[model samples]
Target: MSFVRTLRQATAADHEMVDAHYGGFALDRQADYRSFLTAHARALPAVERALAEASDLPPWRSRTALLAADLHALDAPIPAPLPFQPGAAAERWGALYVIEGSRLGGQLLARSVPAGLPSAYLAAHHLPGEWRRLLTTLDTHAAGQGQAWQDAALAGARACFALYARAAAIA
Candidate 1:
């Protein structure tokens, strides 16, 4: 099995826990949707900023900006700025793994959004081969890891999921 697969299995419980906190696709009101976007806005920029600071990775478009646009279109206030400290390079990759993987699900979530609502964040701008690139990068990062590096990366990914859970509470 590839390291990405291993990482997925290792983090499976955390993934399920985070998903449980997000009120699902059955939202009946625009208010619920706005709250959901606002919660995402609160959490994503921090993770993105940390990734930016720690790695020389080429830019993938910022979902924070996309979320802000959707929030504005919905008349929801943008979330206030939050401080996010950068992590080590390996840790940043781990956190990024969660963020980037969400784009795949965002494609599905975008389908369920009400017709009249803005869905730019879910309708992420496509970059050909982005997921494959990120997966290859992650696999390479994991290739030579010692237990300590693996631990740090797992912790970073878990921290990201926990951050979203906290944001979900506020939403």
Candidate 2:
């Protein structure tokens, strides 16, 4: 299987758990919207920073600022980011997978945001073919690496999901 498929399979439970947690927040309400953005604010920055530090991946536009702006528009306090540091190249790829994948869901979630609410974060999406490019990059990277690397990537994705879940619980 391609690395993207492998990673998705490995993280299926984690992804569902995150979705359930975030789904509890009804984005139609301003208060729930604030909490939702707050939850994301608590996790996204650290992950983005870690990915940036990894540095070998393709250029990524950080959504941290967009997330922060959404919160600021609501007059909501931006929570401190949860700590996340991906230690290996494969691990970083895993973390990036979770982060980037969320954008796909965000496009759908943006509709839940009621009229007049800031949705720049949810509206921010990868460019056309960007996701395919990312998948290709992951598969290429995994092609030469052994099972240990794949395992690390799985672990990294799980860790990232855990961070988001934690943030949701707190929010």
**What C-alpha lDDT does candidate 1 achieve relative to the native structure?**
0.79
Per-residue CA lDDT of candidate 2, range 56-115, in tens? 776667899999999999999989898998777878878888999999999999988888
Please give each candidate's TM-score: 0.91, 0.97
How accurate locally, in lDDT, is each candidate? 0.79, 0.91
Could you give candidate 1's per-residue lDDT for residues 35-92 as a string of tens digits?
8888888889888878767644545667888898999999889986455554656677
> What RMSD does model 1 have?
1.8
Among residues 3 or more apart in sequence or in different chains, the pairs in candidate 1 whose N, CA or C atoms overlap within 3 Å are none
Index of the highest-TM-score prediction: 2
Reference-based TM-score, model 2:
0.97
Off by over 4 Å in 1: 24-28, 81-83
How many pairs collide in each candidate, listed in order? Answer: 0, 0
